[model samples]
Target: MKSKGPPGGGLVYSTESGRMCPGCRQPVAACVCARQPARPAGDGVARVSRTTAGRGGKVVTLVRGLPLDDAALAALGKQLRTACGSGGTVRDGSIEIQGDHLERVMAWLQAQGHAVRRVGG
Candidate 1:
């Protein structure tokens, strides 16, 4: 059953474009509608915490509230991962480093002259 809205309502794929963005109706590679939102403003401090809520009880350190742009944040996340000798990713303006590296992250951030705060128990 389909309602009478309009013909060719949406284009999901194409031979030329390969894939189309629903929001912009442009090719996936050339789409400008799926831009990432700006990071939330913070108090100029980086908060680090360790949690195991998800990931099958595997501990992961989260660094939040860092006042940095996307590129800089990614670079910092990479450095943090290297410093902790583990793997991780940066997403939604936060850094998620695999394993529990609360102290190491805090120390590194402090050494880099960024105010660090330990969050959670």
Candidate 2:
């Protein structure tokens, strides 16, 4: 059987339903869809802390429990780095900014509607 083109000029194939599950956009069998309830703003608390575990005792502002995916986390990290005028990265579901900018980070997170707390010294 010949395949048909999708609505937007993409190719669509036969023998396939060409329909996607709204939740995951995957075929039904492979779909691991879950309805993500909307979390209230400022519900999750972002904790900031300092760590000196492997970087020559340099202080880092660690932001955790952001409830963001990897890509969003990366973007947030970039924004925080820019705001703090420092370098940072997102790893292990947390954002790590160079230096001890806990207060600044907390303020920023609060501005973004996230409850924040300082965890460690």
Candidate 3:
């Protein structure tokens, strides 16, 4: 009796009993598919400032030079907002927290091992 083939007309086989490698299924641990560690980037600084725009001249904190990628910057912005207990957003590689949180945000960023600077009034 002829054995039934796989859906793509290929032979069906199981590697449940050491028939294949658990890492890359190449039957060897020295396979080129080994996992590599990610390189780390040094800590990045953030600049804080207060701006009056589109809000009847109300004060808003602007954070720039966070030196993080899009995803990392978003996460950092969320943390900063929570710490400041206010609303904020990440735009154009910068973070804008509502209200004037210059001192608060500066201290927080420094505590997180980031060098912060005050920019603008």
Candidate 4:
């Protein structure tokens, strides 16, 4: 078997320190670099759709393929949720708004200059 990191250049576990982060060579608990980068790049085009699968009897509006990164996506989700006066969240780089707000969400995204498309009827 071979070591995952560079030879003799990875984390060192000792009584002095509990754990370490190989990325920043810092303590694991306080390693800022270990956190994933927020607002990662994405593909172009944004699509809106409605689905009720696996969610009991509730319908959720799904918005996907937005070019914006995570921070922007979260902000946009917040705005859309507020606009719809409903609860929603961002999951797996997609915005999931509660209830069927496809028309409302499409209009809002189009107003925001997004190349929006209505998907899944």
* Ranking of all predicted structures according to TM-score, beginning with the best and ending with the worst: 1, 4, 2, 3
Instruction: Please give, for residues 3-61, the per-residue lDDT of candidate 4 as tens digits.
Output: 67645687656467777776677777888996776654556778899999999989999
Model 1: per-residue lDDT, tens digit, 38-60?
66889989989999996899999
Pitting candidate 1 against candidate 3, the one with the higher lDDT is 1
Better of 1 and 3 by TM-score: 1
Q: Number of clashing residue pairs in every model?
A: 0, 0, 0, 1
lDDT of 3 by residue, 13-101 (tens): 34643334344545444445665553334346576889997779878898887667779989999999999999989877788899888
Error of 1 at 12 (Å): 14
Better of 1 and 2 by lDDT: 1
Which is better, 2 or 4, measured by lDDT?
4
Q: What ranges in model 2 sit over 4 Å off?
A: 1-43
**Between which residue pairs do clashes occur in model 1?**
none
Model 3 Cα RMSD, 1 decimal: 8.7
Candidate 1, residue 98: the lDDT equals 97
Q: In angstroms, how far off is 70's CA in candidate 1?
A: 0.8
Cα lDDT over the full model 1: 0.90
Worst 10 residues of 2 by lDDT: 5-14
